[model samples]
Structure formats: structure tokens, C-alpha cells
Target: MTEQKRYAILPLIAIGLVGGLLSGLFGIGGGVIIVPALVLLLVMPQRLAAGTSVAAILPAAVVGAISYAVQGNVDWTAGILLAVGIVIGSQVGALLLSKLPVGFLQWLFLGFLLVVIVSLWFVVPQRDSEISITVLTGAMLAVTGFLTGILSGLIGVGGGIIVVPVLMFFFGANDLVAKGTSLVMMIPGSLSGTLANWRRKNVDLRAAAAVGLAASAASPLGTIIAGTLAPSMSNILFSIFLVLIFTQMLVRLIRAKKN
Candidate 1:
């Protein structure tokens, strides 16, 4: 491998390792971590970064969902219903993305990330066990999925931040089940959004593949590690990751304002 390719390997592995653990622990798809890392480490353009992140998320989420499923943590009925809404919402969001300026979209994504970080830090509910999903619960799930899908398409986050919180707070899902369900919902939405971006030549297939393969390979180990961590420790790590990302966004936004 050339110098650039060699340099990319470590980051790819790091992203995969960290992203998978986060996904397994938090019910997040790792897009928040992946997108910012790609931008900071690889100097990838925003559009390609988003697209590649989405692409990598597909496999990572799959691995995460499967792991959670084996632990009897998946709620297939709710997951599939939510996914239906997510697919439609993602398509609409992609259409909107095509009309927006790239800079505006970047700012929007940064703003969204800030909101998620703050919410996860300050407002997320505390609970240890899984909650049951009813018909009423399914309706709420659909709405959350719809909004998450829209954001996923716009920001390439695969909707994990939104999905996890909703499942935890509103739907009353346990952390493990919520994470698994989020991964399940993310599959179709990410795939759809990625295809939309791919049509616009925004996806870097080679880079995505490199990162995704590593992520898939490492996800089972990450999931096992996640299962070992205390919930409080997992929350702390997740909070720190969010704070770091939020700080990065703040710096970029300030720099942009100055420019």
C-alpha cells in the first residue's frame, strides 16, 4: 500500500472498533462518530464523508443487530414497522438534500449533532430494563422513525441518535433492545440514503468498503466488550464522545463565521 492507504488503515480500524462498541452499547449506528472522524482524519469532503459514513454504517449496524438478536434483544415487529416509515422519510429527505447548498447542509448537520449531544448528555432518561411495545407504541415508533430517517438522509447519521432516545424514553425499550432495533431500522434507511447519494457521485465506494469491512469484522468483539461495560461507564464514554464531536463542530462553526 502507498503512504495514504497505509495511513488510512489505522483510522479505519479505529473507527470500526469504536463505532461498533458505541453501536452495541448505545443503540446508535455510529454515524455521528464516523462522519466527524472521517472529516477530521481523512480530510474527506462533507458530501463524500456523509455518504461513506452511511455506507459503512450499513454493515456495522447489521453486525450489531445480529449480535443483539442472539441475546434476545430484538423487537422485530416494531423494527420492521419503523423501517417502513423510515424508508419513505429518507427518500423525501434525500430530495430535499439535492436542493440545499452543501455549506448550508453542513451547518444543519452540525446543528443537529449539537442538539443530539446536549440531549444525550442532559435529558436522556435512566432505566435498566426493556419496555413493552403496543399499538400505540408502534405509532410513536413510526413518527420517530420518520423524523430519524429524514435526518439520516440529510446528515448521513443512520438515525441512531434519534432512534435510541425515542426507544428508551418514549417506547420504553431497554438499552440493548433499543440499540438492536435502531440498527435494524438503520439498514434500509442507510441503504436508501446511500443509493440516493451514490447517484449524485457523493459516495466513495473504495473508502466505504475499506472502513465497512473492518467494522463488520470487529463488531462482534465490540459487542462482547459493550456487554461487559457497566451502563454508567458506557454512558460516560458516549457522553465524552458527544462532547468531543460537539466541540469540533463548535470550532468549525466559529471558523466559518469568521471566514
Candidate 2:
């Protein structure tokens, strides 16, 4: 008898559960987990994995964002402004994904995470500070969103990692509010990116659905947990999470190079 393997949903579900939990707790789109898992565990191509991951983030982001909104942590004006820029930027990124060398993306991802982790230790956000919506600030927020969206499309991220830190560190927003608003910004960003990926035949709907449903189901639990943690502790834990991911990817890259 010959042993053969085909598609299975179990791994996808397992990946989704972990990804969703972290997404809610850290206010990220879970692409950090999904993209690598798809590429390493499922033997997916990097570009395709990124595209599928973006598609999956849509549903999970919606669920997580609503949970945060229920706690009154979301900023509608700031989020909307960010979304407008993200909508246009996602298309630009999606276009770039096909043209740019995939190796460059790995470096970009690793570098950005390092910068964010370092930035977190120096910044402590107050829970009471909210976004002061001035015209200049709004324009800055939109520009921030546009740049983040481009990276999101290229990397299959939901933009929360960058957005959350930028909101808390630069905008003087509360940690929770930054998280909630980042989730909200991801909704349109993911949708727009997913559409572009779909047109490029980069997305696999079956895989996306499997991962997304599992992630959405688990997301609220993470949101509930996030509310119980202190902002300082949350930043510490998030930094640890990023470190682990960074290490994992580095190890994988080393192994790939050795092969």
C-alpha cells in the first residue's frame, strides 16, 4: 500500500485558533501566524499564502473589532480616516506583490517587527487619552493608513501591528483604543486587499474560509482576555509574542538557506 496525503482542514483550524486568539489580544490581523503556517506547514507559496491570509483576516477582524467596539474603545472618526487611505493603498500594495521580489518582503517584515518591539518598551500609553481629531492629525492618520495598507497588501497583514503602535506612541491614544481602532481599520483594508488578490488568483477561498471561521469563533475570547490585562503588561506580552515570531522566522530562513 502506498501512503498519500491530500488536503485537510484540521491544521487550518488549529492555526486559526492560535492566530485568532493572538489577533484579539494583540490587536493584529493574525497574518503573522497564518502566512508562515501556510507557507511552512502547508507548503504554500509565499505570495499565495499572504493573499489567502489577508482573505481570512477579514472575518476575524470584523469579529474582534465588534468586541472591542462593544467596550467603547473604538474611534470612529480616526478609523474612518485611516480606512479611506487604506482603501487606495491596498490596491497599490496588491499590485506590487506581483512585481516585487518576495525575498524583499521577508526582510521588510523582520525589520518592521524589530522596530515595533523596540518602540513598545519606551512608550507607555494612558487609558484615558483619546484621539484629538484635528485637520492635520486627520491627514497624518490617513497617510499613516495609506503606508500601512501598502505593507498589508504586500505582506498579507491586517495593518494592526503597525497601526496599534503608531496610535499609542504617536497619536497619544489609549492602548485599548488603539487596538480597537486598528481592528476597525483592518475591515476595509482586508476587504480591498482580498479583492485585489482574488483578481490575481492569489487567494484560495476554501482555505480562507476554513481559517476565517475558526478564527472568528475564537476571537471574542481573546478580546475578553485583553480587557483584563493592564496596558503595560499587554505591551510586554505583545513584545514577547513578536520576539517569538521573529525568532521562528529567522530559524526557518536559516534552515531554508542551508538546504
Candidate 3:
């Protein structure tokens, strides 16, 4: 590689490493980190950054998912069912994105996040033993997946925030399992989305590749730590994470309005 290219690639790797850590720690796809880093550090446009971020998420998801699976935290059937629904719902979300007003969607998302935050904060999380995959459970997971996918397509997030809480509250999954299942569900959708972005020439392939490789290497460490944390602690941490995300999004939306 050229000298300048090597220097540029270093930052992308750093971004990926951090994103990967968050991904493993919280079951996110890490676009939240990748998108902003590409935009600010690489001076990429927002659309291109979003597309490239999707590509960067692929490896992190894979590594994190495997790590969680090894720890017995992943529910394969739930993840698969969610993935199927996400694929279908993403298309609907993309269609809705253009039809809905920007402010309306932004408000809606923020409100939903707020509700989730409140729910996670106050509710006593379910025990791990309570988790089971019945037909009805699978159906509920699919519905959650659809909502997750719609939010992903509409707001460009991985929807782990939504998924984790839903799994914990409604499906009786523990925090680690909820995070793991969410990570597993992200793999297929991220791959598909990345390919679409590549087809549209929206990805910075070189930078994204660097990010993905580095993220894959670092993600397992995060999963290890997450597995060790107390369930109550994990729930609190997850709730706090959602608050930060919500605050950032809300600020950005307000600034956009002022502009």
C-alpha cells in the first residue's frame, strides 16, 4: 500500500476497533460509530458514509455473533426468525422513508427510544432460565425483527437498542442472551445491505475493508467482558447506552431544524 493510504487506513482500523468493542458489548452492528467516523475523519458525504458503515458492520457482527454463541448466549431460532422478518420489513421501511416527513420520523424514533429507555430502566429484567423458543415466541421475535428492520432502514441504525430490551422484557431473555441474539440477527441483513451499497458505488471499499478486519479481531474481547458482567449491571449499562444514542439523535435533529 502507498504511504498516504496506509495512514488513512490506520484511522479506519481504529474506528472499526472501537465500533467492534461496542458491537460485542451491546450487540450493535456499529454503524453508529462507523458512519460518523467516515464522515468526520475521511470527509465522506453522509450517504456514502452510511453505505460504507454498513459494509464495516459485517465482520464485527460475525465475530461478535460467534463469540456470543460460544458462550451459550445466542438463541439461533430466534435470531433466524428475526432475520427473515427484517429482510421483509427493511423493504417496507425504505419505501416509507421517502413518504414520511423527516421531522415526523425523527420525532417518532426519539419517542420510541424514550419509551424503551423508560421500560428498561424500571422493569425488573427476566431471568435467563425463563427464555424458551415456542412457536408464539418465534412469532413475537419476528414482529420485533420487523420493527427493528424498519427502524434500521428508516434511521440507519442497527436496532440493537430496540431488540435487546424487547428480548429481555417480552421474551424473558437475560441481558447477555438478548445482546447475543441481537448480534446474530444482524449478520445476514448487514451483508445484504453492504452488497447493495457496493452495487450503488456508495462504499469506500478500501477503508471499509480495513475497518471490518480490525473490528473482527477486536470484537471477541468485548463479548468476553459482556459475558462476565452481572445481569443487573448489564441492563443498567444497556439503558445508559440507549440514552446516549437518543440524546445524540435528538440533538442532531434539533440542529437540523435550526439550520
TM-score of each: 0.84, 0.93, 0.88
Give the CA lDDT, 0 to 100, for residue 56 in model 3. Answer: 78
* Candidate 2, 1-259: lDDT as tens digits: 1322343799999889988998899889999899999987999878888999999998889999999999999999999999998988999999999888655666777888899899878887888999999999999999999998899888888889889989988899998899899999999999999999989877877889899989998889989999999988998998999899889877877777798
* Stretches of model 2 off by over 4 angstroms after superposition: 1-6, 253-259
Residue pairs with clashing backbones, model 2: none
List the lowest-lDDT window of 10 residues for candidate 2: 1-10
Candidates ranked by TM-score, best first? 2, 3, 1
Which lDDT value does model 1 have at 254? 80
Which numbered prediction scores highest in TM-score against the true structure? 2
Predicted structure 1, TM vs. truth: 0.84
The best candidate by lDDT is 2
Give candidate 3 regions above 4 Å deviation: 1-7, 92-103
Model 3: which ten-residue window has the lowest total lDDT? 1-10
What number of backbone clashes does candidate 3 have, counting pairs of residues 3 or more apart or in separate chains? Answer: 0
**Which of the two, 1 or 2, has more lDDT?**
2
Candidate 3 per-residue lDDT over residues 1-259, each given as its tens digit: 1222322878888998998898999888887777767777878766667666767777888999999998888888889999987776665555554455546876888898788888876775645444688888888889888877777655556667678778887888888888888888887767656565555555567777898888888899889888887777776787787788788777878888999
Task: State the C-alpha lDDT per candidate.
Answer: 0.74, 0.89, 0.76
